[model samples]
Target: MTVTIRDASLADLSVIASIYADAVLTGTASYEIVAPDETEMKKRFQSVTSQGYPYIAAVDESGDVLGYAYASAFRTRPAYRWLVEDSIYLAPAARGKGIGRLLLAELVARCEALGFRQMVAVIGGASPASIAVHQACGFRMVGTLTGTGFKLGQWLDTVFMQIALGDGNASEPDPESYPGTLFAG
Candidate 1:
């Protein structure tokens, strides 16, 4: 099935929250045990987009949200502003179809365009599929937190992967650029 990646809107929050809830409850893609409702999800959507970061949804030809992805501050400290973390969640039917990779590629492109210099993947549960997907999109394993997550009656590892974005660290960013406040740090 053809999947289209586009900016996520409030109208898509319900479906996006549903996709994330499944991951929260059954999958280890997210460390959040209690799934947030659509309202909370909308707040999160606004927070990310308001920061000039991207929140995107992957939809099928029928306009159904197959999955969603986004980038957010890797850390709140101003020194970490140029680095961002990525999150992706897919409907059960959407997995194994390479949709995650496509969504991630788009997210990376968007973040790069926004002047983000680094993209990080904090893959919960050491999920091989997630790890492979990130690797396929140019992410390299930076580290892993052993037994950092407790879920589904077992200890889980969180894998950290990273990739350089446009001109990544090859040159200094212009402080007066698109992502204005960030480059100054």
Candidate 2:
């Protein structure tokens, strides 16, 4: 399939919500017990895009959204402005197709271009597939939180992986620049 990656639009929220709902219901990638409705997904999309964070979708030749990814503030504190967290979800048919890597690579590139110094992937349930994709994109295993989540009638671990963007910590960021108003006083 010829897949294209582009900025996610308001119209895409329905499919995005469906994909996320599937993950929430059937997979450990998300920790939420209930899949949020489309309205909630729309709110999240606006929250991310309004903050100037990159939110992208991967679509097939027919323009169907196969997967989506985005970067969001890792933390609300000013000190964490340089770090951003990544989230990705794919349709059931899209898994193991390298689409995750494509979406993640694009996210990393866009975040770096926006001056973010680091990107972190907090893999829920310590999913091996998620870890493999992150590793393929140059993220290194940082740490793992064992038994941090309970879902599907069992305990799950949360894994942390990180990758440096741009100059990373080698140089300090300009005080005047940041992803949107996340650091605004």
Task: Give each model's clash number.
Answer: 0, 0
Give the poorly placed runs of model 2, Cα more than 4 Å off. none
lDDT of 1 by residue, 1-185 (tens): 77899998898988998998999999887888999999899899888888788889999999999999999988887778888999999999999999999999999999899888999999999999999999999999999999998999999999999999999899997656647343343
The top-ranked prediction according to lDDT is 2
C-alpha lDDT values of all predictions:
0.90, 0.95
TM-score of each: 0.96, 0.98
Off by over 4 Å in 1: 178-185
In model 2, the number of clashes is 0
122, model 2: CA deviation in Å? Answer: 0.3
The RMSD (Cα, Å) of candidate 1 is 1.6
Q: For candidate 2, lDDT tens digit of each residue in 1-185? A: 89999999999999999999999999998999999999999999999998889999999999999999999999988899899999999999999999999999999999999999999999999999999999999999999999999999999999999999999999989977775777776
Q: On a 0 to 1 TM-score scale, where does candidate 2 land against the true structure?
A: 0.98
